[model samples]
Target: MAKRDYYEVLGLGKDASADDIKKSYRKLARQYHPDVNKEADAESKFKEVKEAYDVLSDDGKRSTYDRFGHVDPNQGMGGGGGAQDFGGFGDIFDMFFGGGGGRRDPNAPQRGNDLQYTMTVEFKEAVFGKETEITIPRTETCDTCHGNGAKPGTKPESCSVCKGSGQQEVVQNTPFGRMVNRRACTNCSGTGRVIKEKCGTCHGAGKVKRQRKINIRIPAGVDDGAQIRMSGEGEGGLRGGPAGDLYIVIRVKSHEFFEREGDDIYCEVPLTFVQATLGDEIEIPTLTEKVKLKVPAGTQTGTYFRLKGKGVPKLRGYGQGDQHVKVTIVTPTNLTDEQKELLRQFGGLSSDTSNEQEHHESIFERMKKAFRGE
Candidate 1:
């Protein structure tokens, strides 16, 4: 069969730079590397890409290929050229393809798994930051053999299955020709190392389970379900990898008198009839301190008053939110004889105060406007 053009295979022009050739080869190889891309033609495409990079990467081969206009060794079978023949091209293909064998250390230490701890904070604490401690069940590096999973003074040995490569190369004879697949060695569990003298404390496992107490500073304005990550505070890694991260999932307990919406705080302030009609200055409890709220005369129920800069602070910015206080008028339930007589006299003077017909008309107008989507 005729061979494809080396330059066309890599999607590069004849004048492409060395760096350009390398970058394109890396992308194409990683994409169609066979073990990564399991398509039937992935092996052939990978081979084509490797062949292109082999010739274009070398200065002398690139000159020869340009002058002779040939990339296939079988096409121009002569070895009349002096020094640079096909001697170094195999190494170029090996580097471009990242080789067919996995050589990563299976026994190499890796980062520990990420851990999560759910903590419940009071509503006030969530609004105003607090420092607290939590106990978590996690794993840490074993004391005996120092995470090698071996007995004291004894270290793990290289795995014989993959010859300490941590990867086993399996060759498959398929219709597409011989395909090589590298996988983690089953005997070593991909660590490329095996321990014969197991640690008595951790029982061959690199980690030991225990309860740990961690102190964390919960920042203000952190809402419920917010996660705070603590670096290098998770389980210890196998062999000797870096520790993973610890995530704190916050659960803020709901306050009886206050409710939060985003950064704003909301609460209902109850007012008596005398306070609402005659007006009064009342002290309301905020997140930090109590502030005086003045109710004007004729202040109706459901009236909202905003206390600026009293709500929760912004988690990511500078300004704070406002606290919205809504008033709810309370009616007197019990009345004495003298009070009943005074109320009757007051009702006689304020006869037009109970204008039900006009209130009905206002409600009907609102309903009509709502139906019209006004």
Candidate 2:
């Protein structure tokens, strides 16, 4: 079987850019992967397209491919022959797949991982805001070694395996020709250095486990599951890298009387039957203190009253939210005999069918219709 043109295999024009070639190859690879597509000959077709893309996607190899169709006369380009001697494929793999063994720069500092800590705050603390201290276990730079991982009088030495390159090259036989790839050196694990004498405290790990105390200032109106970030307070990085961030996740404890919804607070206020029949001023609980609430005369059960600016303050803006008090008129649960006789006399004086200035007719009419299946 003869080889197909690289452009034709990837379904692209001869003038297609390297990025275009990569995009085409990624789509085809996903569509024809052996794990995804179990059809016969799918693997072979995928390999053929991959090889074509691998060559034409690189600038040097594409130059050679343009000169000789599917065969680079200068560098042996034919299948099973001399076409696969190009070394630029490593760059292509690194660019496209982020693989093919690139080493981390030993001189460069890396950022550490972010850590999360759950904190419990009282309802009042969440509403009014408070500053509290919390302790977290994290990795810190070794005080004894100063993050060098070296002993008292000795220092780390360059790796002998990779000769300070931090990478090892390996040659493999491919369908086109022999290919060389770079991999991370196993001996030094790509650091390009080895610790000769271990630090006694850190044990040559360069970091020590320690508990960190961090103080966080929680803002007002913070609800449950709120997150606050403390920068550079997490685990210390390796090789003298920068420290990570610490995130405090807030969990507001349940309040005894109030429930929060956004900035508003809701609570059920109990009222006596006489207070509901006649107007009265009642004391209700607020996040800060008790406040007087007005109950209108003839107020029905489940009546809601709002007190402006009595709720939590807005976290990001000005002004406060209102508090909603739901009134529940309670009937006398346990009545004494004298109390019952007084109630019976009061009932005798009041007419059974009396409307009482039509104030109580609405509730009675609604109940009558409801019982009649209206």
**CA RMSD for every model?**
12.6, 12.1
Q: Per-candidate TM vs. native?
A: 0.64, 0.67
CA lDDT, every prediction?
0.80, 0.78
Error of 2 at 14 (Å): 17
Q: Which residue pairs collide in model 1, if any?
A: 106-191, 106-192, 107-191
Evaluate candidate 2 by giving its C-alpha RMSD to the native, one decimal: 12.1
lDDT of 1 by residue, 1-374 (tens): 88888899999999999999999999999999854675889989999999889879977667657765654433322345432222223233333355423233565668899898889999989988899888899999997767888899888898989888776766655444554555678999877888898999998897999999999999989999887889999999876789998988899999999999999999998888778878999999998899999999978667789999999989889989999999877666788999889977865665565776653454336435544556
Candidate 1 Cα errors over 4 Å, as ranges = 1-104, 167-186, 317-319, 337-341, 352-374
> Looking at candidate 1, what is the lDDT of residue 20?
96
Worst 10 residues of 2 by lDDT: 87-96
Residue 313 alpha-carbon offset, candidate 2, angstroms: 2.1
Candidate 2, residue 160: Cα displacement in angstroms equals: 2.4
Report the error of model 2 at residue 168, Å. Answer: 1.3
